[model samples]
Target: MQTGEHPQLQQQLMVQNSSGSLSFNSNLSKEDEEMSRSALSNFRAKEEEIERKKMEVREKVQAQLGRVEEETKRLATIREELEGLADPMRKEVALVRKKIDAVNKELKPLGHTCQKKEKEYKDALEAFNDKNKEKVQLITKLMELVSESERLRLKKLEELSKNIDSLQ
Candidate 1:
C-alpha cells in the first residue's frame, strides 16, 4: 500500500504466509503475464502505425522536392535562352544609338550654317530696299528740274522774236 510500489508487488507482499515464507501464486502471475502481453501488443501496433505514417510523409516531401528541383532547372534554362536571344538585339540597339548620335552631330553644324545664310539674305534684302528708296527720290527730283527748264526756254524764245521784229 506504500506509494510508488507496483500493485502486483503489493499483492505478492500481502500473500506471504504467517510462517514468513514466500508463497508463489501461479494464478496472479498468469494474469499479470497476460496483461503485460496485451499492453506490449498494443504498443507494438501503435509504433508500427507511426512508422508507416512517417514513411508516407517522407515520400511525399521527397516527391515534391524533386518536382521543385525540376521546375527550377526548367526556369534556369529558359532564362539562359532569353539572355542569349537578347544579346544580338542589345548590340543592335547600341549600334543604332551610335548612328543617331553621329547624325545629330552632323546636323548641329548644318543648323548653324542655315541660320547664317538666312541672316545674310535678310541683310542683302535690307540694302536692296534702301537703294530702291534712293532711286525713287532721285527720279522725282529729275522730273521737277525738267519742268523748270522748259519754262525758261519758252520765255527766252519770246524775247528773241521781239528783237528781230524791231530790226526789220
Candidate 2:
C-alpha cells in the first residue's frame, strides 16, 4: 500500500533530538519519506501564509494609530483656538468689571451726597415754612393794632367836636 494511503504515516510526528535537530524516529519506506516531505512543504506554506497575515494586520494597526495621532493633534489645535477665542472676551470682561467697580465706587459717594442734600433741603423747607407761618401771625397782629388805633381816634375826635360847640 502507498504511504499516502497508510493512516500510520500521517499519524507519525517529527520530533526534536537532544541537540534540537528535527529527526524522524521511525524507520520508513520510500513512500513514507515522500509523505513526510509533502507534510513539511505544507507546514512551510502555512507558516508563510501566517507571516503574511501578521504583517498585514500590523500595517492596518499602524495606519489606525497614525490616524488617531493626527486626530489628536487636530483636537489640540482646536482646543488652543477655542481658548484663544475666549481670551479676548476674558480680558474684556475683566476690564468691564473693573470699570463697573470704579463707577460703583464713584457712585457710593454721590449717593451719600444726594442723601445729605435731601436732608438739608428738608430742613430748609421746614425753616421756610416756619418763617412763613410767623410772618402770617405778625401780619394778623398788625391788623388788630391798626383797628384798635382807628377806633380810639374816632371817639376822641367826636368828643373834641362836642366840647368846642359848648364853649362857643
| 1-168: candidate 2 lDDT, tens digit per residue | 553454554444333322456666467667677777787677678889999999999999999999999999999999999999999899889999999999999999999999999999999999999999999999999999899888899889999999999999
lDDT of 1 by residue, 23-107 (tens): 5546556655555455456656887999999999999999999999999999999999999999989999999999999999999
- The Cα error of candidate 2 at residue 152, in Å, is 1.8
- Clashing residue pairs found in predicted model 1: none
Clashes (N, CA, C under 3 Å) per candidate: 0, 0
Model 1 worst lDDT run, 10 consecutive residues = 1-10
Report the C-alpha displacement of residue 81, candidate 1, in angstroms: 6.7
**Best of the candidates, TM-score:** 2
Off by over 4 Å in 2: 1-85
Ten residues in sequence with the least summed lDDT for candidate 2: 9-18
| lDDT value, candidate 2, whole model | 0.83
